[model samples]
Target chain A: DAGVTQSPTHLIKTRGQQVTLRCSPKSGHDTVSWYQQALGQGPQFIFQYYEEEERQRGNFPDRFSGHQFPNYSSELNVNALLLGDSALYLCASSSGGRREGHLNTEAFFGQGTRLTVV
Target chain B: QKEVEQDPGPLSVPEGAIVSLNCTYSNSAFQYFMWYRQYSRKGPELLMYTYSSGNKEDGRFTAQVDKSSKYISLFIRDSQPSDSATYLCAKKRNDYKLSFGAGTTVTVRA
Candidate 1:
């Protein structure tokens, strides 16, 4: 069985440009969450999608958005990218659609798409 | 202040030695704690997870959480060169989003 998979292992974009990164969640998983990991730092949550709707979001601005398809794949779109937006974008998949009680379900992550803004 | 604070240690240790890593969180409401390992140019992989204040051991890894102190720890026993990577500590409340600490990079020298 394949784990989480992300497209375009690496990307280069210019300021004010938009970039879209894709992800396919692990088999049997229904939820997808995106994270941004800057240099020398841990990943910061961007947002999470369930049932094709955003259920949770982080501190990111409106420029960062995401979509989840019925197939459980996800796409992260960053508009008007800034130099600071350059980082490794990670996609993680979990089994629960909506979490309740204790969250014991483990999340699996992909290798991540490296985005560099020049 | 950050929700979770971890020392970013480029810690170097000899192979076969025990490696210790720690992180502290500002929120007492964080109930789920986890430790993730990430290699260079790679995404983090979950290594250990615990919901309560105690130690959960799996092979060479042991995850410890102290709710009263709002601290978490991960210990690697008899580490190997392959263990060299950045270790991230993450915490989450009853909500869906996970808050992470700055990762600690470890290099196990042979």
Candidate 2:
């Protein structure tokens, strides 16, 4: 089965422009999570979508938002993108039951979209 | 202050060497610990996960969680170049939130 898949493997955009990144969760996965990994940094949680609703979010600003469709495909939208917004946008999918602390599942990730805000 | 702290090391080691990566968190409430491996320009893949305190071993990867010390570690045995990547330690801060460290870059020379 295909693992998490992302779109626009690489892209360059001018400052003030907007960008949309897409992702399809791995097979049998029902939850989708988005993360941003800057150079020399680990992936930072953006938010997680379950049952087509945003179940949780991180310390990101309003400019960063996302949506998950009925089919478990997700899209991340960033408006008025700044240079600092340029990073490798990763999409991760988790499968399994939920627990108190964690969702209690293993996560698979997409290769990620390399966004370069020029 | 960052919730999780990890040394971003470009740690180099010879083949078959044992490698250890660690992270510390300020949030004492964090109960779930995880380690993720990411290659160049690629997304991170789950390497290890453990709940509460103790050690969990899977093959050459061993994940240890010390809740009392607020520290966690990932050990790789018989390392290979394929294991060369950034190892990120993460913890669940709340019910559905995860906080990740800066990641440690490890290069295993084959």
Candidate 3:
């Protein structure tokens, strides 16, 4: 069985441009989350989508947005990207069951997309 | 102060040594704690997960959570060179999001 998969292992973009990263959740997973990991830092939560809606979001600005499809696939879009936005964008998949009330579930991650804004 | 505090150490140790990584959080409501390992330029992989205050051991990896102190720890016994990576400590916060600490990079010299 295939685990979580992401597209465009690496990419380069110009500052102020927009970029889109895609992710396919692990088999049997229902929810997807996005994270940004700067160099030498741990993954920072960006947002999470469940039931085709963004359920929870991190402290990121509105420029960082995401969409989840009915099949549980997800896409993260960054508008007016800044050089500081260059980092590894990670996508994690988890079971949304019981997530509404603080119940936690294990998350599986995909190999991140390395986004570099020049 | 950040919600979670961890020492981002580039710790070097000899192979077969015991390794301990820890993180402390300010939020007492965080009930689920986890440890994730990430290699260079790679996404993090969950290494251990613990609910509430207690210890859970799986092979050489052990996870411990102290809810009273708002602290959590991950211990790796008989560490090998393959274990050289960045170890991150995180907590399930706000139900779906996981607040993470600055990962500690470990190098096990073989």
Candidate 4:
């Protein structure tokens, strides 16, 4: 089966420009989450999408938002990017939603998109 | 203090050496512990996971958790150069979201 797949393996944009990163969850999975990882750091939770709505979000600002389609695919959008936004954007997928608490859900990740803001 | 703490070690070791990575968390509510390994310019891949206090072994990897001290450990046996990567310790607080450590980088020299 195909694992989580992310498009535009790499991207470049100006400070005032906006960018969108896309993700397709693994087969049989229903939830998708987004994360950002700066150099030499671990991935930080951005937000999670389920049922086409955002279920949980991290410490990110309003400038960062996402969407999930019925097919369990997801997109992350960052508006008015800053140089600090230059990092790796990662997408992870799990099988279910809220019930994930006690289920020992293991999230599968994509190769990630490298976004470079100039 | 951060929810989870880990050593960011660019630790270098000779081949076949045993490697030990550790992380400590301040929350007792964290019920699941996981270890992920990420190569350069790539996403992290789950390596091992454990729920309770004690040890879980899989192949050359062993995951140990100490709920009492809120500490977790991952041990690698017969380490190879290919084993070199960044290791992240993550904890789930009875919820789906994960809190990750700063990640420890390892390099196994041939």
Compose the digit string of candidate 4's lDDT tens values, residues A1-118.
8899999999999998999999999998889999999988888999989899998899999999999998999999999999999999999999857575664378899999999999
Across B1-110, the per-residue lDDT of candidate 1 in tens digits comes to 99999987889999999999999998787468999999999889999888899899999999999888888999999999999999999997888878899999999999
- TM-score per model (chain B): 0.97, 0.95, 0.95, 0.97
Candidate 3 lDDT over B1-110, as tens digits, reads 78788887989999999999989998776467889998886789998887768899999999988888888899999999999999999888557888889999999999
lDDT of 4 by residue, B15-105 (tens): 9999999999987874789999999888899998888999999999999999988889999999999999999999877666778999999
For all candidates in order, the CA lDDT equals: 0.92, 0.87, 0.89, 0.91
List model 2 lDDT by residue over B42-104, tens digit each: 788888788779899999999998888888999999999899999999887546656789999
Worst 10 residues of 2 chain B by lDDT: B91-100
If the candidates were sorted by their DockQ against the true structure, best first, what order would they fall in?
1, 3, 4, 2
Q: Which residue pairs of candidate 1 clash? A: none
Q: In model 3, what lDDT does residue B22 have?
A: 86
Across residues A80-102, which tens digit of lDDT does each residue of candidate 3 receive?
99999999999999885554655
Query: Once superposed on the true structure, which residue ranges of model 3 sit more than 4 Å away at CA?
Result: A102-104
Candidate topping lDDT: 1
Best by TM-score: 1
User: Residue A111 of model 3: what lDDT?
Assistant: 95
Clashing pairs in model 2? none
